[model samples]
Target: MSALSTFANRDELIVGAFAQDLSEVAERGRATLDEEVAATAHPYSITPSSLSHS
Candidate 1:
């Protein structure tokens, strides 16, 4: 039981770390995309809201 508990704890920690990394990556990607869109001067002008459904 003790060994199983340790293994589970380790697994949870790894999963939590992975999730944090993924979240950071997603934030960076969104920021880069937003910067690109803002830099682009389109005729109609496409804002972030215009690309969203809601």
Candidate 2:
């Protein structure tokens, strides 16, 4: 997650919403990583609006 700071593009940063716990987050990450444009950073604390309702 911290490694994302090396890039100049904050636009590259995306919040993958999940439960407060990391279980859902990890699952989401694995799924997305199979794509070409995968997430480069995982924020430590996502904003309230960024949280998943599902």
Candidate 3:
């Protein structure tokens, strides 16, 4: 959660770079970024419990 919360901010920065317009397409693309996130969730998930066990 900690690591993901951190990267979520970074992800905003990265996505912001490409989100420079107020067009519907841009908004739609931004609104639908969750699929990308969902696909990457497993690799990026870092729970406190996992670290404690390690």
Candidate of highest TM-score: 1
Order the candidates by TM-score, highest first — what do you get? 1, 3, 2
Candidates sorted by lDDT, best first: 1, 3, 2
The positional error of residue 48 in candidate 1, measured at the CA in angstroms, is: 9.1
Q: Mind giving the per-residue lDDT tens digits that candidate 2 earns over 1-54?
A: 575675634544432222344777787887878653435545565757679696
RMSD score of candidate 2 (Å): 19.2
Q: Give the local distance difference test score of model 1.
A: 0.92
Alpha-carbon lDDT of model 3: 0.76
Clashing pairs in 1: none
lDDT by residue for model 3 over 1-54, one digit each (tens)? 699999999999878866764466777887679677766779658867778954
Q: Candidate 2: deviation at residue 41, Å?
A: 21
List candidate 1 segments past 4 Å from native: 43-54
Q: Which stretches of candidate 3 lie over 4 Å from their true place?
A: 21-54
Residue pairs in steric clash, candidate 2? none
Would you list the C-alpha lDDT of every candidate in the order shown? 0.92, 0.57, 0.76
Supply every candidate's count of residue pairs whose N, Cα or C atoms clash at under 3 angstroms. 0, 0, 0
TM-score of each: 0.76, 0.27, 0.32
